[model samples]
Target: MQVTNQPIDAIHEEVFADTTSGIGPELNLINPQPESCRQISAESPVLSNIELAKLKNIPDFEAATIPMLYKVADGGAGLKQALDAIFAAADKYIAEGKCILILSDRGITKDMAAVPALLAGAGMHHHLIKNGTRLRASIIIESAEPREVHHMALLLGYGVSGINPYLAFESLEHMCADGMLDISFEKAAENYISACTHGIAKILSKMGISTVQSYRGAQIFEAIGISSAVIEEYFTGTPSRLEGIGLDEIAKEVAMRHEPAFAEQNIDPFSYESGSHYQWRNGGEQHMLNPETIVKLQQACKTGDYKLFKAFSKQLRGSAFANQNLRSMLTFTP
Candidate 1:
């Protein structure tokens, strides 16, 4: 059962191909008109929609009010203070009948060290809900791939109402700036947003859901490897299978990832883990689809050898690629 030409690379390229061609037509779905859905903008200094459309408006959504965007510090001791302020702000907004809060994690680090903050935000949202405050929570993260989408779904199960993957937009900007992409920044951003929306929609569809509103805070997922203590606190009501790392462990993990950024700050203020984005480069960030692994997976797929594919996939499951690519979709029993 020999397979044909290796299509893994081609499939990867196609999955992330330029989406500019279909963006304009999807604007109505991405940013619904005020009449279609109540929309609000928080007057704040942040990434311009020219870089990424952070706001999402769906017509006839369940929510009666639009969300107020809130940006907070990425991580550190200051994170607690920032979350306190965010909670206060959310209280005010909820009192004012703004039932949705958009927690923006753009301009954050590549490792997603802000997961703790996201959990804290979810906790606050749940607190409000418990106190009879009618409100919802959404997140704007730097997610890119299908695995990232699954992570977002986890957040949704933990109380996230919506998600926007701004990293996809930033990747587009970088590609266009590097001349690897021919589209303008705005067009690329639009296309990226559309792509993320499509990805999220597909995830929901798999669960027999037809709309994002229905999926909000549904807790439709099970945490396989997370601590019960952490789950009890931030992810209340959510079930965890294995006893995993706790909040302290999570904080330590985030600190470890942030250490390099702080240590090398003097060398470059805007320094980041190189190759953490769309392109895979050495000594930058962790990625699943590196040249070596992609080559191996491509070879296995081309040969139609299930055993070969399994070997490559076993390696992938143990690597960072497990959380960044659509590895679940590549299952082969043989």
Candidate 2:
């Protein structure tokens, strides 16, 4: 409701509030060791533990995946330790029929992405039948085709999850940098909604209560740490964001229609790039995209003539823009 009194985080807490019966602490999924799940305080712009934990609980809805963000003091040892901790928690979830998706953060390499995928595939039965199909792992690499990443998700049988708004926004920024308009108006509006939804989801996930509709609505660029004035201004064009409306109101707007718009396909990237580690909002892990196939995303990002940068960003793989050349190209000022 009254978002003025509510800070962005507070509103998110309200929107994404976890109604799922005390899942985190009860599950004890985080590491017991001080190193594992060790709380770190970040300065402005960086998300907090409370906020990161909010997302930690999000994979429960359908087959969801998220990248793991860990801080390591040692050179590569930290990576191994973090993976160990992740697998430990992953082992439990897989044993229990719950599928856990892992995307490694910066410092994680293509090799790392492969390791977890191999482990999860092999242990799918033993760790699952004995426990449940709880853990699954992936590494995000560079690809132009958004579907390349989507297809991988399908192969894993996780259905498609929209980390779309995040990608769309990145794409928008990428377009802006290039001073070229490749996105369409319809796509822009869609991205606006998604960006708003993602922003709200991060806030709710921080508070531990994000839902499908809420997450989708929170991705609006205005919702993610931007000023309220800006958020309201952007939503002016949307039918959903009426004059007196707030996020909770917006959440209600898209809550009922829950299925993904397009059918999942077996799209994989032909020309892919690898990175040591790439990152995204909500601490997403390194992702794979096909720069060569990115043309497929033209339709997805190009919504009519509007070129909704925000929506198009969502269609991109989380790591598609992490490349210096790509990021520079996207953000390049004409």
Candidate 3:
């Protein structure tokens, strides 16, 4: 947990600035429109489609009719049917020379892997090519990132052209509505989407690629805990460094997570996870900010105790707080 000398936020801001300034030919060249931009909202705490559309128009990026394929109710069979239908429709669109396709999981809560599976299946389909040229249509993912951005990158490496982190946008909307965030809904949404785009850019840059198009299906990563069989059947061409679980194991993990909510027979009011962001909660996933450690760090700074500050710094360097934005404010003078 050694903290970088430069703060993560500052690094991100610099990268974002560079991206916007066109410092690199790949930076800020193209920004994809999220599916949420289609919704019209008056009192809602999220940017309406109209506003985002206006922004998109500034860059001359028209929102095209990107067909959405949602997850079906039945298991694999249902998914296959849905994929077939989507591919069929895609063939029609490609024949018409459409430039993009969107796959959405707006109301889907289970079998989230189906989205990537469908994407892989689409990549395998012959209709994606015409006249010995790959169909120019890009596949954008619209329902992702309640899990991990790495997973999103994995999808991108597999064949996904763009990503719209809908869940993260919804979370920002909730935060604004609950007074946890002070910014306007539009700004929050914009900032969050910008951050996500920056992240994607960073991921691409790491692989020495400047553009998202090149990053698509680059397959630069090696999976650690997925089985070879699953990789071969579904996540084809992606290397699995360590052989582990198969698709059944992955589905079992998904089922275990789903069972908790499904078992709740009576509807009850929902509460946000304690320490939802910026802090770690008991029985919850880890976060970068630790309340107790932050308090101690503040105390050390107030008292001007160099020894105490060093101790606190050492402690922080070992915990998740090393990555927290507050780390930028800490300057070590030795």
Where does model 1 exceed 4 Å of error? 1-85, 96-100, 105-117, 136-147, 265-334
Model 3 lDDT at residue 251: 46
The best candidate by TM-score is: 3
TM-score of 2: 0.25
Expressed as tens digits, the lDDT of each residue in 59-79 for candidate 3 is: 323233333333333444444
Scored against the true structure, residue 13 in model 3 reaches a CA lDDT of 44
By lDDT: ranked, best first: 1, 3, 2
The 10 consecutive residues of candidate 1 with the worst lDDT sum are 18-27
Candidate 3 lDDT score at position 43 = 21
Give the per-residue Cα lDDT of candidate 1 at 245: 76
Please, what's the RMSD in Å of model 3? 11.7
Error of 2 at 135 (Å): 11
The Cα local distance difference test for each model comes to 0.51, 0.34, 0.51
Q: Model 2, 1-334: lDDT tens per residue?
A: 1123233453524543421111121122453554323322211111222333444465542223334433322323443454456556655544454433333232343222222232222222233224433223221211112222222222122211222223344565666566666666446535554444444344544433344322222232222222343233332212232224433333232232111212155435332323234433233343444442345456546655335444455545345555433343355457
lDDT of 2: 0.34
lDDT of 1 by residue, 311-332 (tens): 7778787745556644543678
RMSD of each: 11.4, 21.4, 11.7
